[model samples]
Target: MTPETVMEIGVQTMEVTALLAAPLLLSALVVGLLIGMLQAATQINEMTLTFVPKLMVVALVLLFAGPALLETLLGFTIRLLEGIPELIG
Candidate 1:
């Protein structure tokens, strides 16, 4: 592949990576922020307090979103594979 094609693929890979991670990361971030707020309000300075909630939220997200995520990844893989001949040619 030409440099441009390589760069395009790299950029797409990054985008897909970010897209896949965004839901989990955002959920954790929101849970962390909410936990932080709750801790501040109650004056409970427990660091481990946020960990469980974030983990649970991420797990739930993955459980619910896993199929869609898999489909997305599968679609990308198929597209990349289909383009191989064009890339080689």
Candidate 2:
């Protein structure tokens, strides 16, 4: 593959990865921030307080977004695979 082709593939892969991961990561971030704020307000400094809620929120995000994420990844994979012949030639 040419250098440009390689860079294009890398960019596509990263875009797909970010799209698939954004939901859960964002959910976790929001939950963690909210939990932190609550802890601050209540003066309850628990080391492990955010873990369960963050996990649960991320799980919920995955449950909701899993199909879309899989479809996106599959589409990217199929496109990449289909381009292999052109890349090799």
The digit string of per-residue lDDT tens for model 2 on 1-89 reads 78998898889888988898889889999999999999999999997899999988888888888999999998999998898899999
Q: How many backbone clashes does candidate 1 have?
A: 0
- Candidate 1 Cα errors over 4 Å, as ranges: none
Name the lDDT of candidate 1. Answer: 0.94
- Candidate 1, residue 52: CA error in Å? 0.5
Best prediction by lDDT: 1
Instruction: Compute the lDDT of residue 49 as modeled in candidate 1.
Output: 94
lDDT tens readout by residue for model 1, 1-89:
79999999999999889889998999999999999999999999999999999999999999999998888888899999999999999
TM-score of each: 0.95, 0.96
